[model samples]
Target: MLPSPFAFERPSTIAGAVRAVGKSGDGMFYSGGTELLLALKLRVIHTDRLIDIKGINGLDRIALNDANDIELGARCTHNKIANDPVIRAHVPALSSLCANVANIRIRSVGTIGGNLCFGEPHADPLTMLAALDARLVLIGPSGTRVVHADDFIRSELETVREPDELLTVIAFSRPTGPVTYRRFKHGERPSVNVAMAWSLGPSGRTIRSARVRVGALGSRPQPLKAIEDVLQGISVAEVRPAIEAVLPTALGELEVNEDRHGGAEYKRHLAGVLLLRNADEAIAAAGSA
Candidate 1:
């Protein structure tokens, strides 16, 4: 299936892209055109215009600023992030996730902002961003406003971006402690990916902070905050029970429809298994560091 007829514009400036999208009201931004093109071909979305931002300068660069944060342009591709030295050194968790976001082909063309903005439940960026407490910079007619990763995605394919706003930059603080990230994938479908990141305190025995993000199990990425709360200040030996205690509660809220993979029960079980395995790996990584 081909996409519905749509007008295309290559906006040279951020303001221009914002104006175009604002005017069409039904326009979608295109970067790399990997996912959007596929969605369009499948008729998953209907739009009157395509505001291509590839022509816009400066949105494709990756930089680590004076604030010691990794700042990425909206158009930065997965491959760029995965291989960037700054990103690798500062936020290896994000780099690890990016490295695993499909094969090299998809990563070569998939934009960081495009992936996050699409809000796919199983996308790696959401989970990694949640762990890093990333911030999104949105530019609109009214100027720029920043939003945290946690508040950006309201639901599956739903975001808080205004019609006139374009996501320009994604920024996150550098990780101060040793970080470990792990994920489970169901074959190569790029769905039902579950990931968790863990960081230990100075004492090296207590869990200072942690993040648990489950994708492909629900309409939106689910963070296991209850489990995170339980892990805080606990010794590594006690983390397993904390993870187990919240597994059922976390899986209960997901909408795991039967797919080629398996049934809801199977997905729920996978989520628990992923939580345990990743949690252990993360703890181990921190302990060794």
Candidate 2:
């Protein structure tokens, strides 16, 4: 099916783009339109107007800020991110994830902003971003507001973004230790994915803190608080045994859903499996560093 008739407007400025969308009342800001255009064609989403922000300057930049946080412009495509020197140096795991997202065609054209805005639970970026404690910057008529990645997605296919707000940047502090991600998939999207970020002690062998997020098993990626708690203050050599001890209880805490991916129990099991795999990689990274 074709998309419903809609007006199109291209704005060269962020303010102008926001105004155009707010004025239309049902207008959506268009960047790489990979998912948006598909949703439109399938009639899964409707908009009276598409406010194109592609002409806006600086929305596709990737840079390290004065505070040492890495900022990714909302319009940056997966292909660019995967190949960016800054991304590869600061967060190679994320660079690898971007390089492997969907296919070459989608990576070339799908904007990170659109992926988060679409809020598909079966997707990738959000899970890793949440684990990295990334913040999303949104600009609207009222001004700019920064939201934690974990809080950005409100539900499956839903986010906290206001219709008139434009997602401008994704920022995160440089990782102090290893960051790892793993996913299990049988189709276009992940059935289960896990992202884990660690903060090691000065010795670089002790885990001072850990953040674990499991995705594609619930409405949104959720923290495995139980696992995180167990890993804290433990040495890399003890991670496997420690995780194994608490694995069952931690897996039980997840709120998984039975869908085409698998049964709820099966997904919960996958989450545990991926977390351990991520833990192993993180241990190796920490050891080598």
Candidate 3:
């Protein structure tokens, strides 16, 4: 089905885009048009005005900040993030996740901001950003503000962003050690994916710090903080059971449903397996480095 009739506006400047959104109560910003267009066609989203930001200059570049953090432009595509040298070096887990998003065609046009903003529960980046403690930069008439990625999502498909605010960039401190990620998909499409990042600190032969993010298992990517807390000073081999033990409680409050992908029990089970495997892989990678 085709999208409902809507007025379109291409804003060449950030100010122009902000103004356009402010003018209409139900306006939606257009980036890669991958998810937004599909939502519109399905009548899931209705907007009188579509503000296109793709033509705006300088919003498509990817740069690493002085702090060694990545500053990903809101318009940066999945393909760009997946292949960017800076991203690969600083956050290899993120790069790996981006590379696995959908397929080549979708990644070519899907923007990072779009992916996060769409607020899909199963999307990979949300989990990665949360685990990395990434910050989102927003620009609006009231000026710019930085928000923690974990705090940005208020609920499913909801965020703190105001109507006039444009998500400009995402920034996060780079990981200090080798990182690895693993995801379990059913027949090529990812049913559940887990990402683990590891770094070594002053303590020798121990996990200095770790971040675990579980996707496709909750409304938002649920961080395995309980497991992380358990692993902080313990040997990597000793933490696997703790990781497994926390799953029932970690996901106790969440509502896991049976979808075309799998049953509730299956998702719950996969979440545990993926977490164990990812944590193990990340720990091995950190030790090897």
Give the top-scoring candidate (lDDT).
2
Between candidates 1 and 3, the one scoring higher on TM-score is 3
For model 3, name the residue pairs that clash: none
TM-score of 2: 0.98
> Number of clashes in model 1?
0
Can you write out model 1's per-residue Cα lDDT over 51-70, one digit (the tens) per residue? 99999999988888898887
Clashes of 3: 0
- In candidate 3, position 216 carries an lDDT of 69
What C-alpha lDDT does candidate 2 achieve relative to the native structure?
0.93
TM-scores for candidates 1 onward, in order: 0.87, 0.98, 0.90
lDDT of 3 by residue, 55-138 (tens): 899888888778788788889998899899988877877787788888887899999999888887767787778777789999
Better of 2 and 3 by lDDT: 2
RMSD of 1: 2.5
Please tell me which predicted candidate would have the highest TM-score against the true structure.
2
lDDT of 1: 0.78
Per-model CA lDDT versus the true structure: 0.78, 0.93, 0.78
